[model samples]
Target: MSTNLFSGARKALVASIATAVLLGGVTLVTTPYAAASTTVAAVSVSAKINAFTNIDWLNGVWRTGAGFSIPATAANQAAFKAGASVRLADGQVRTISRQQIVGANMSIFLDGAKLDGNKVGAPQVVTIGSSVVTAPVTSPTTVTAHSTSINAFTNTDWLNGVWRKSPGFSIPANDANKAAFKVGASVKLADGQVRKVTQVQVVGANMSVYLDGAAVNGSVVGAPNKLSTAGTTTATPAPAPTSPTTSVIATSNLNNFTNNDWLNGMFRASAGFSIQASSANVAAFKAGALVRLADGQTRKVLRQQVVGSNMSVFLEGAAINGTSLGYPKTVSVVSTSASTPSSPALTTPPATVTPAPAPSAPDTTNGKPLLVGVNLSGAGFGPSVVPGTHGTNYTYPAESYYKKYADLGMPLVRLPFLWERIQPKLGTPLNTVELARLKQSLDFAQKHNVKVILDLHNYYRYFGKLIGSNEVPISSFAAVWKQIVQEVVNHPAVEGYGLMNEPHSTNGLWPQAALAAAQAIRTVDSKRWIYVAGDRWSSAFHWPHYNTQLISNPWMRDPKNNLVYEAHMYIDKDFSGNYFDKNEQFDPMIGVNRVKPFVDWLKQNKLRGYIGEHGIPDFSPSALVATDNLMSYLRQNCIPSTYWAAGPWWGEYALSLDVTSGKHRPQLPVLQKHAKTAHSCTSIGPL
Candidate 1:
């Protein structure tokens, strides 16, 4: 027989024997022919193929039988169309013929014969273990196949542009190799060629992958040399874990404060952060942050809150401005565990400052009757003349002198005292003898129910030098008054303190000295009125020309408002009592007209005025008319006036009202008439 016929006959016999084995156990007759057939069947069984329909079972070694068939599916057809090698059960490996899919079945063309699917039970998948097998790729193949062998590759279609792991590297797109690819695993990049995705930002139309490790433009996988997802690729780094946040408390400074929004109860500033007048800042302050004020004092921030974009830090217990904070200042933020130290006390400004509070307004009678009084200088002007020698001491009259005046129905007396007599030397104790004389007069006045205006009878000087001149400091004058007040301030008969007897030659120092003395007197005695004389001999005619700053400025204000401006007026044209020699030239209305400005100024400034000293020479028609007109004007204005003098030494002097011998001067009746209305004076007839 030919080799072909024998091969065909053997294949047919193997098929028949397989069918018989499937039905039941085969009974073999012990003969030479039967043994030969059995041996052939056994040989064929050892070389038969193990077929599989499922792809997963095709992993290990498999063999091809004598009549192998291929599946008609595209995945199978494409895989076998490229001729594949497979191991037989007998350990013999052979190359399978290329196959193709025809409709729902397969067409196999071997060596020189064509095989169709009709002879096979179903299309078989021929796979082998330990070795990769591939077939000739048919032209116009509709699908691509993946390997089923241990060394097989992954389908590029299955990759679909994914990242896959390679040896120490990553392929970032579709790749044919499947050595180390996984679903969700991390892998390393190429050795010494590391890369990091610093940022993944979207560009105009696509995402830009920025890498810090290497200079590569990361684009989609379709580009040349670009990595694809199908291949083994390194994995991206996991995102870093988030860190937790911490909170802290802080404070703000006043210098940085921009504005306070009162409506919102917020304080805004240039500082980066704002503090609230409500919770946090307030709580922190109560918790103890010391705020230093502009006055160099520290206060706790008692309340604070944040409203809108502003902060409200309250220095006082409540949230307010000015009184509590006073002025904005430095703030020290203290920690919770620390204790705050006390702040220094705020100091008050001196009273001489210009912006000080105005003194209280003087007593207001609201258009009451005018008061008449007398000026007496015997106790203050001098000592009894020492033959031909000048003496610094003054010989004041005995207490009976004042008693006599009080007995004459004098309600008030302007009693003068020399500053030199009271304080002979700067900073020395007041003269005891002079003070005793003053006390004696005060006692007499008090016994007789008369008010005494204690006068400092100096011509704006202590010893022929101006009070505030270089030779005699104004401070010394103030010291003297301060001492004098200590002695006489408590006396009930002391109606007021006359700041000066007649301050001429002051040269602008009168205002400063007067104010100083008034302030000094005020320190010890607040209720008693103070008579502040004007500059230039307290002249009524010169009142307008005097520096009115002393009365106008608040700094010179007597805190008690018990100040009466004292002005002196003489009826003569020169405002000098020495004009008694020219008494014939006196005009009754001239004195009244000249004093109008002084009265108008007092009214304009809402002040009180006292004519400390004013007089006409005698009861002549001109003198009486002048004196009456002056007194009538003073009465109409409700101003108080005191006649020039009744000193024991002024005997026969012009303008003197000396009654030592019980004889009445001609001007006495005019005085009694005007004064009788204000006090309890006797009604004396014309002299």
Candidate 2:
């Protein structure tokens, strides 16, 4: 799960500038925060390497390096190093040449023939893991409506493929609707919500009608017979008066809550929440059941989970007010009044209820592979140096780099950086120096019409501590990401957040940690994509072994429906980009085979996929064949990828795509061939 590490630095800047935020129309011009001076524990490679071995690397060839023998004692483990003779479990002595974490043991190569006796030879993998609007019609009004017959085009973009807009609704993108649902026009919902058709999203099979962000019954959706000449309006209906009675059935003490609940149409905890529960109360508040709460809110129960003496209940409606549910106070749960509006329960009595569709992977790419790009490395280098000196220790891609790549048809660039350098300390504002550099690179990419992935290239560790460890709490991870997103919230060139560069040895906590950070990011920006990598170095070959969540229960639950899983693949004996053996031959399908599990997993789970890192060193013609084959396979699957990489400091590196004399590298051409395929596939507006 390791890649070649590099170093660079960020120089502080003091200035104010305007930047566009994503997901809406807002811009901010603010001064940068000064860098902070702090000390952190130096990384312990043995601890890190030991953690990586916890997973089974049945697909050994895809791991970073190799190891052979097991260390029998704590001293032996500490003494372990390349070229050190280590005692095996059988007491046999073996010299360690190259070692990598491969599923609960190090896969070592002794003198290059590659014999990883730790069950590393086969594929022992198992697996795991928006809007609408409307308007009216006219002029033979190219608009037509069917109440519920035509299902809105479903894609991986939204759950049930629903593109919902509050106060608005979505309709099938049939020919007549496409012509009639024009922006600036108005559509009146069957209930009398008059909304302006703000925009239209036509990508592959998805042609959505946005009614300035509204939701309505599909049957009532259609073009208005005529245009409205005034401001938007919603017909209000007089409330039916009733003397509803409330009977207190149960009361419980509120323990805690969070605001990131995912309940749709149901009243959800705006922040997470928990209450003491016993067997008696758990059943009384089952899904689809309605109850009146002291907060003056009535909602249908979505679901409930009980662990120990605590229960978490999700309800459908507007977000619940956590503050109103006073802690340490007994909250009354009352029987619903006959006078209050109600819907059938979400569970039980199937004949009377239709539960909301479970969240599904959005078909964002429209069955076509996403766009191809290259890793613009450098900013993430020099992990050992905190707030490293810019230029000497680290650097970001220049404007020319973006220009050259965009000109070459590579419209995406995955930019990696150390989380430590940006924030310096957890829960603190980002260092102005690092922030300015990142913004500069983003601006350059946007100018070139290229999308960028802001990769937190910290290897799932901040300041040398694995995330979720006491030293690095998961909340800190979420906090950093939340702040980062706030800084660039909706920068147009920003594609997604590479949550981590390559995570390894996360103690089975990566999934929870990753999701926590994602939820935090969503709190600020919900429209941008979030690229999640698997544990065990995010290896496509070993994805199933390291990440074993069932497809039925995906680990990622993005509130915004833009979560894309990422994996890395390198075609070499060790799956490391070093390529020490220059003349090694490779099967043309080697690259494809290594990455197939990841692709297949994505398919089985119905999720989006991305190849975050894949590279072949020069000097091996067969590697080129393998690279080309892998690229073709990705194109056929409609998955996007970024080559491993092009940067300013990678002088003479085998896999470096850093340009020289204005000439393109051999690998660049291979990537270029697949880059243009996504261009015509789907358009979600701009990068």
Candidate 3:
């Protein structure tokens, strides 16, 4: 066997990913990811033959000029040793079986018979399952035998068949944990670290990998049974998890999530929160009378507003990047040392024989606080563009539209993506065949339920006018959200980065391409949640009251809540202006009394405000009484809206109550009259 097909082969793989910044001053200096460029470690030379690409080393042993003694189980034996040389490693394959004759006084001559010691130089490693003697044959010689067969594994190693299956049982790729074994099941890995796959590469979305065993690249089988159509491994995706993480605990308290009451999840806080002002930590738990964030991860509590005793926690759905200057203002829980009277290794618990384990508060009926539901006007159902034409068919499947809003209890789904079909091939990267069909629609919006604000319709002048670009530059639109959050914000129901659509400075570029794409998405994602798009989206002449002194700069305070401020009320088109030149005294009751100057600038900037994108224009005139008098003046001015066209407009310009053809289409018996789908966090916040 002789092989050397080097049409160029170099490889070095090391993935450690660690990004926990909230640093502020201390001489900052980030931007470092370009490492992987190595490749030169395939060295296994044997005294002298270096000339390949389909190999060339015959006369050395293929017959003549010097020494040789080949026979290690010799059936198809090959060993050339004129000047004795052999090299193979990069994609290895070369079978010689035996031979050695090196320097000044060499000695070896196989078929010509002459078997003894020192011969030439000294190296060894033939190949009948890696035999020996290529250089180190300095003694007797008579190894006439050959046998080969390899494979072993209980935990792993011996076989390099890289296996992956991820679904709800999402270990290898997507499932994470439901619907057992899949694709011809029996896929057991993680044991002893196996290594013999040789080839298996299926990537992105519908996924199907499997190299030598054959499949090879592309086949999540047209994916999308759900995980919101296989996209949310928890959005903002990019090779996420940079790793400062030791004990990021909080998953299972999305603003007050209450489920079939069994009990054990914490955080119901109200009075300025306090775990004693936390440096927050609670390890990967798993004992469960109530120990969650140890795994199902997704427990957080702070869209900012907890001051005093401070409070911070993580894990329950990762990405706690910079809760305003990286959390933990002041905490110190060190007091645990008092049980030393040991005795009872085998028999002891009978104080009446009780103790079934008790201590749970069913989150006091989820006092409400974490809700991440982003579906921005492509509302309820709208990715259908056969209208004018440039191809559009993601076929509504945000994991079955968030398991029908998690079976109507509704928790979250703010997911939108259209950076011109996710970078249509311009600067080269992130097209992975439409990111594997948008990861089967973000794994069907993270397997039925809710939590995923990944919105970024990125209107870089409409992707510079469908990839023609007249001026698409805001740092190439922050490198299309730093390359789709560097390839999708590492899952947990993705709750971050909603910065671009409806942003405006208009033909002039506001706040410098919106503060340079919000400081380049907080300089490569600094702690999640960053939805800032007023200008024309939340318009009262671009709502943001001249950035009210950039909220005492802490990058506009509210970082911990991770910043959110958008306002849009097109109250029947930019808050009704002329009732025929103020004739009817501008009635709709003075256009609902001019929304108190943008609700007093969202309580003077403690802002987490949202009317995030609106619409109500399906031929206006009391369009469902102006959409029930504009959601009863935004629930009596506490303000929270998200309606805009689902097409033939029932988004009433505020958009889709679910009626594409008439009689107010369908899903909105106007939110079943006086809207408020199940329980309440007082109207979605913290996620």
Candidate 4:
């Protein structure tokens, strides 16, 4: 049994093997034999024709008989070039080229004409040098020959009814053709030529058939009927399907986001088997026309569809079949005058004026109410450096720490965890003890109705090897995230998955790895928001320049389109949150202006921005004022921000928001001011 070489590139190459067959030189023959005889003699010739370029012409007309022979002579080349014509077995006259016949053995067939000692009359058996020639009697005798090689055909009874043309030929595998050879049979080539098939041979686990005395190793032969304009034959290719043209209707910032923005600006609905309109109908849609929805509902456009602007009809209560407009629903223009306008009924007021009802509170659980959050640090940065300890121990805050902050009206918390603590060894399940400690903190936050953002605090490296590098495969990083997300993704308190804490690398490796991790998380939980950060510690200053590669990567986009870009901003003169010296004093408004470019970029791309970490030092009036101004700026722009931290390890640390001397840090008052405007998690509300 031969193995099948019918897969991948090798299979495609084998399927195209017939094209290569025209480039090689081979021979075919016909012989005259007795009709009653069951046995036939064969001859095999192995020789190359010198400088023969017209292999197609030779394959079509060359045949062996008693009267014809091509001689290796210069005069024959001259005669052929002058104007000589050869009559083919089918009675068609074709001009012969010198390059096709020089030094090549050939045969000629003449209708009703005799040559040499052989007579052209009926199907007869003729012997020549241990080779048998079988001729079928017709208006012109059909000449046939057999091969003498070990794998040659033992009979020639199959050459009876096969027909051939210039580019089309048919050799049905009927009983006669099958009986001619045991494992293989002779078939007519596309160029009206007969070729013999002998046996199937195995070469390196692949099956190959010998055709026309030549080894055709795994080459694919085309159907005989399809012919090329050059008089050569090839497989007929399938026609390609046409694609619809896409037109951009709008481009705008996140604040101006509308239903069309979420839909990626695709507008067209199906009508029977075709789309109702495309770019060609843009003029109609822009003229306040009626359009059909995919669900067969017709709605009138309230206003003209903006071509290069960001405007939404969804705001005008536009919907299809009671469902809100979204992606994959095609919309098309119907009529220019059709229109539907929304009107609210007015009722007579009572003698005393009653105040209108208050608007319902926005969903804060979805990260909507100006995220005032604090970074919880102990679990992720590893165990504290304590005296007389090996530093291998892992530490986490007790429930009281979470309770105190929850009581302070903080609505969101950013929780960081170490990768090594969860998975000490590659490919192993998350460590049971470490997972329990992390879950304990998460449970405390849920008790207080505070949402948590799980942060993977690995800096794009594991065990001293950069991810996506030779040392650690990017798949390994994605694998750990898959396991981690499965454990806490469904937790009610968990709001979003922060793919990584910070990535500061080059050549787009950080974004590449971030995309891999984000995709892995999406596989488990598609609805949860995922936070993706750029390289260089997700710096706000270099966001536009350094993160260009990531922002442009199509793969970096989330399938759900629920991604929030995370960036860290610091306020010192050097843009580092290290110190707050008096000499480095700068106006709070100036600091806010410095970070506006990043905010503008986020708005322009229609992407949500989250300040994952930012902070200030001390309770001085100058520092407190700076914090107040920056927080206000972020809130006004609808940007969610989390303060740098409050943890058990920080005792009197300058930037710590932790309680000290039984009083809240000064930054708490600043945070509380912004929290008052947001929906509170605690009954006490903002201080």
Pick by TM-score: which candidate is best?
A: 2
lDDT (C-alpha) at residue 318 in model 3: 23
Query: Which has the greatest lDDT?
Result: 2
* Residues 1-687, model 3: lDDT tens digits: 000111001000111111111111111112222322222222232222111111111322222333332211111111232222333222233333233311111123333332222222122222223232222112222221111111110111111221222211111222221122122223322221111222111111112222124331112321111111111011111232444333322321222222232111122221011121212222212212122222222222222222222222322222222232122221111211332222232133322211222422112112232321224333222222311122333333435445654554344445556665666544557667656655565566566534555666543245334212345656676667777776666654555566665543354354455455666666666666666655443454335454443344456554454566655444433242111111111122222334445556766655665555443332232333334444445544444444432322221222343332233232243433333322323332322
Over 1-687, each residue of candidate 2 has an lDDT whose tens digit, in order, gives 343331111111111111111111111222223222222222222211121222333233334444432311222222343455543333444565544321112334444343343443332211100122333322221112212222332222222223333433334333334444545556544455667766543321223445666354433442321222122222222232356766656544455332223221122423223554544457576776665555555556667766433566666544445455444333445564475444333233323223323522223322223467888877876677777888988889889889988877776889988888898888878899889999999999878777788899877888889899989999999889999999998677778898987888778888888888887988898777788898877889888888764122343732246788888988777766556565587854678789898888877666778889887765454566567667767765667889887867765555667734333344665666555432223422111
TM-score to true structure, per model: 0.44, 0.47, 0.23, 0.46
| lDDT of every model, 2 decimals | 0.48, 0.57, 0.34, 0.48
Residue 305 local lDDT, model 2: 65
In model 2, the worst 10-residue window by lDDT is 13-22
Angstrom error at residue 387, model 3: 18
Least accurate 10 contiguous residues by lDDT in model 3? 1-10
List all candidate RMSDs to the true structure.
Answer: 55.4, 26.6, 27.7, 33.5
Candidate 2's error at 601, in angstroms? 0.8
What's model 2's lDDT at 234?
29
Give lDDT tens digits, candidate 1, residues 275-370.
323233344555235554434445555444443323445443222233344223324454323344454432332122111123221122221212
Task: For residue 477, give model 2's deviation from the true position in Å.
Answer: 0.2
Off by over 4 Å in 4: 1-367, 383-394, 580-583, 678-687
lDDT score, candidate 4, position 356: 19
